[model samples]
Target: MNNFKPYYAVIFTSTQATDIKGYLVMAEKMENLAKQQKGYLGMDSARNEVGITISYWESLEAIKNWKANTAHLFAQQKGREQWYNWYNVRICKVEREYEFTLE
Candidate 1:
């Protein structure tokens, strides 16, 4: 089905981290806190040697708000300081979307 429109997606990609001391704690806090923010659609994350986290937002502003949040700010500092070796964030507009389900 393709009903979603005007949505935004934030893709976070990172390589294996070496000094991720409090990464898990901070990540959990961010996830829980993000759900309480307005315009939150959903989020999905996966990792191996590399990690990726994709979060959906109703608008670009909401995503920006999240990015600038205080807790997120701390997380960002932590990432740069210890957690991630390298990372990149990409924002994209969802012009169309399709999903499938089986029962």
Candidate 2:
């Protein structure tokens, strides 16, 4: 991720539907698309029983533009129709963060 501190984070949590047939393909596409957008800092994601994705952005306008993007809107429609059984999205202002590593 970029050192874009004081950024925004869009947290997406979901449980996949039983039939996730094009989910991975679409997810990859969306990630790639997000990278092309303005103010896209970075993203992190993981999944097992439930999936979580956190996308960092420079501003709320950037987040809003991404949400209203054509392909993303399609993906969102597909997510409601096919990909996710349940999902939640939270947007937050990340004032600060810290990490630990072993050397």
- TM-scores for all candidates: the values are 0.91, 0.94
Tens-digit lDDT track of model 2 for 1-103: 6674599999999999998999999999999999999999999999999899999999999999999999999999999998899999999999988899999
Which pairs clash (backbone N, Cα, C closer than 3 Å) in model 1? none
Q: State the lDDT at 38 in candidate 1.
A: 93
Worst 10 residues of 2 by lDDT: 1-10
lDDT, candidate 1, 48-99, per-residue tens: 8889999999998999899889988988898888888889999988888768
- Residue 29's lDDT within candidate 2 is 99
